[model samples]
Target: MGKIIFYEDRNFQGRSYECSSECSDLTSFFHRCNSIRVESGNWILYENPNYRGHQYYLSKGEYPDFQQWMGFNDSIRSCRISPQHQGSFRIKVYEREDFRGQMMEFTEDCPNVYERFRYHDIHSCHVLDGYWMFYEEPNYRGHQYYLRPEEYKRYTDWGAMNPKIGSFRRLHYFQ
Candidate 1:
């Protein structure tokens, strides 16, 4: 099981809500989320209800403010716990839509995709082993996208607005 707490004010002040599982709509519990504390497990926080809009990937840690998690705002309306993966991680990145064009396979974290793949745009991907997080900028900064073991035939398949992928890393439990 996993534990996470959402705070309505920064530094864990104000009204708060504790969650152990997936929540499709957090609006009933709190109007906004300014801070968060992940006591266990990994999670993905969504900006809009029903798991839409921007996404923020978080592991066991404390986020004193929304910006600490790289949030664009305090609107965290949904969340889902990422299942722990104890095995290896594997993913294949493609340069064009529908799994076309140049391709590269990765089993380890890539802080800068362009440094290894020689391109910043990854249009499609196949997650073959474990959960992964795609970032819009190098060094795992900017927008985040959570991906499970599946096929993403296009950028939109993984909820990305564009094909620009700067960095990527496997999602694992934090010590």
Candidate 2:
């Protein structure tokens, strides 16, 4: 099982809440989340309740403040534990919606999509194996989107407001 702790203040002060499973709404436990500690598995923290809004992917580590996890603010209303994947990773990216344009398959991290695919936008994708994280900028920076094994027919299908995908990486669980 995975374990995670949420702190209401930066530097792990104030009230706190421990969670081992998915939580749709965390308002009752705390008004805000300024810090977090992921002791076990990977996790995805949401800016709004019910898993809606911005997402922040976190691995096993200590986040002394929201910014450490690239959070836009201190508000974290929901969270979900990412299942561990022990197998190989595979993913296919498309340059247009509905999987119709140029395509490329990736088994490892891509720090710059344009450098590898010669394209700045990924309109669709197919996660054939393992989980992946899509970033809005190169080097795994900017907005993040967690994708599991599935077919995304459009950029919106991955919860991205735009088709710009600067980088992507396979999610690997760390002990």
Candidate 3:
């Protein structure tokens, strides 16, 4: 059995969320236990979202691993994943993402500065899928540029894009 927690405010309004579970879908996992109130403490935190519950106290700069991240994502049933810049999150760690739907592959520009702006003739290049798109600098959009790997060349360049972008598409809220 999974646990559900409700955070209540002085206004009598409350927010609800839950942890991961063996169950497949969203509804079964986020139990609506409105009457159950959990204060600002980790005495109820857990390891496995569903099975083992271990409460933990995380301060401002803490970061959870991929599983915990996914568990939080699932419990909230949200599409947003907050990106952390420093500490544990900024560092790359091997993670299992078998439950995710589609994966995005991104390649950064080389020569550092080339990542920002190219000199003479070369432009900043980033290959997200089959095709490579030229930008004035790296972090071109500051937002992720999604593209379909198969149809990459069709958009800008085709020849090298095929091999470059295997098959990935930009993911938007609508898509």
Candidate 4:
């Protein structure tokens, strides 16, 4: 099971709500979320209700502020735990859209794709197994894109405006 807590104030103060399951609408629980604590399992926090709007993927940790979760603002309206993957990690990135152009496959985390693939952008990708997180900056920083075992024919398919990907990391199941 997954466990998470949303706080109305930073440092886990003020009104708060604990969630162990999916929540379609969090308005009833709190007006806004400024901080969060994930005690177990990874979760995808949505900007709007019903899992709409932008998504912020979070692992087990404490986010003292919205920026820690890479949130544009303190407005988390919904959340859902990420399902654990039992298979090996496998992913392929393409230099062009629709899975075209040069390609690179990875079974482990890549801190800098440029070093390995000699590229700086990823237009498309295919995840064959496990979950992955694409970072806009190197060393797992900046905007994050959470990917499951699926196909993303273009950067837009993964909710990105441009194809500037610098690194990627795999999500591991805690239990």
Which should have the higher lDDT, number 3 or number 4? 4
Off by over 4 Å in 2: none
lDDT of each: 0.94, 0.94, 0.25, 0.90
lDDT (Cα, tens digit) per residue for candidate 4, span 15-101: 999999999999999998999999999898888897766678888899999998889899999888888876799999999999999
Rank ordering of all candidates by TM-score, starting from the highest: 2, 1, 4, 3
Q: Where's the lowest-lDDT run of ten residues in candidate 2?
A: 45-54
* For every candidate, C-alpha RMSD to the true structure in Å: 1.0, 0.9, 15.3, 1.9
Which candidate would rank higher by TM-score, 3 or 4?
4
Error in Å for residue 87 of model 3: 27
Q: Tell me how many residue pairs clash in candidate 3.
A: 18
Write one digit per residue (lDDT tens) for candidate 1, span 105-139.
99999999999999989999999999999999999
Query: Which of the numbered candidates is closest to the native, going by highest lDDT?
Result: 1
| Model 3 lDDT, full chain set | 0.25
